[model samples]
Target: MTIKLNLIAAACENMGIGKNNNLPWKLKSEMDYFSRMTSKTIDPTKKNVVIMGRKTWDSIPTKYKPLQNRINFVLSRSNLDLKNCKDVYASNSLESCIEKLEDNAFKSVYETVWVIGGRHIYEAALKSDSFHRLYLTKILKTFDCDTFFPPLPTNLKKVSDPDVPEELQTENGIDYTYNVYENTQFGK
Candidate 1:
């Protein structure tokens, strides 16, 4: 069985994603969009799986630990300790997580497996053939950042956003919009 792996993120004009392991900017709308997209599933009983690097998991606030109503999978080579957080699992690598999802017990139970990342995890997903779509938010303003989103592969094509709810959203003097890119060579 094949799983549709997806990656989602928001980045600034400079492709910056974070500063000191935390989001560099505060855009409530953007955060809300992220929350909605990640939480959504065709069947409410089955939760989506979010695979994130360990640092990304740590960066989320304590109260938001498991990101509610979603299955959290953290990628880490170290001994992972979730500190009694419910609905969270640990994987040693991205491949391991994907392999686990391919398990018969989980394949039908999950909706979408999203790679919610730190820069490195995003880069790894971009290089893999298993990932299908990118739900990227293009932030128009520049921000001081220490971490950045990886460069997009030339093989992926950004689809038209005519049907997007907020195709072009401008808030707090910053213009941004959601963009979807599909792998041009995916099925081959």
Candidate 2:
């Protein structure tokens, strides 16, 4: 069975992801969009995995560290203890992590696995041929950020956007678009 990888993130015009370990904006619409996109119930036959880099995990608020109801896999070189986290695993390389997950038979049961990130992990996913869909929220603003999402791949095509407002522009002087791309297009 093949692994179905998905990405969920927001980025600035410069692809900046975070500033001072926080999101650049607190748009309610963006939060709603994120919740709607990621709240699907996990398929029991398949395992749902959320992969993130070390810094990204640290960036998450202490209250939300152990994101509820899904397996959390962290990619880190350091031997940090992740308390209150369920099914926590760590790896130095994305490939090795994926291999371990596969070896443990994670894909056979889960319909979709997500690569939730904080910049570096997103870059790794973009370069690899592992993902099937990219769920991005382009915030219309630039921030002083140390992390950023990588550019979208040309091969993917937009598939859905039910909530994007017409003529909607971000308060930060950037024009944003909500796009979903599939790895393969069945027809024009």
Candidate 3:
């Protein structure tokens, strides 16, 4: 089965996504947008899935996770003990996690699949055949970041999304815009 997954993240002008394994900047609105996008589901009985690298999962504050109302999948090569983690699944690779989602038990439980990231996970998601759309918060300013998002493929074309406001958004003296990009090759 073809699983179409969306990638979501906020990046500065230099494509910087993080610093010190945490968000380089915090904008409540941006965080709210992420929460809304990943948690929203048309079917009340189903929940969306958020896939992330183990580092991304670790970066999240304990109080805010397993990120309420969504199924969280953490990918790690090492055996991460998550048996005690509620609403979270640990998988060795994105493919393995996706395979689980394809299983009969999960097929009807998940409404959508989203890749919320770390550098390498984003890189892998972008190249996956399942890659569909990207919801990117483009920060107008640059930041000093040790981790960066991968450059977008030329095949991705900007698309408008009603959930995303077209007007520029400003927060904490910084300006940014919401951009939705679709893979033209995939014909969504």
Top lDDT hit: 3
The digit string of per-residue lDDT tens for model 2 on 49-155 reads 77888887887787876555556789887776776466677788888877876775555544556888978888887766677778776766677887778877778
lDDT of 2 at 159: 73
User: What TM-score does prediction 1 earn?
Assistant: 0.94
lDDT of 1: 0.87
Off by over 4 Å in 2: 42-47, 161-177, 184-188
User: Candidate 3 at 173: error in angstroms?
Assistant: 1.1
lDDT of model 2 at residue 81? 79
Give stretches of model 3 more than 4 Å off.
Answer: none
Cα error, residue 30 of model 3, in Å, equals 0.6
For candidate 2, the lDDT comes to 0.71
- How well does each candidate superpose onto the true structure, as a TM-score? 0.94, 0.79, 0.97
List the lowest-lDDT window of 10 residues for candidate 1: 158-167
Q: Write the per-residue lDDT of candidate 1 for residues 124-179, one digit (tens) a residue.
A: 88877787888899999899999999988889887864434655898888889899
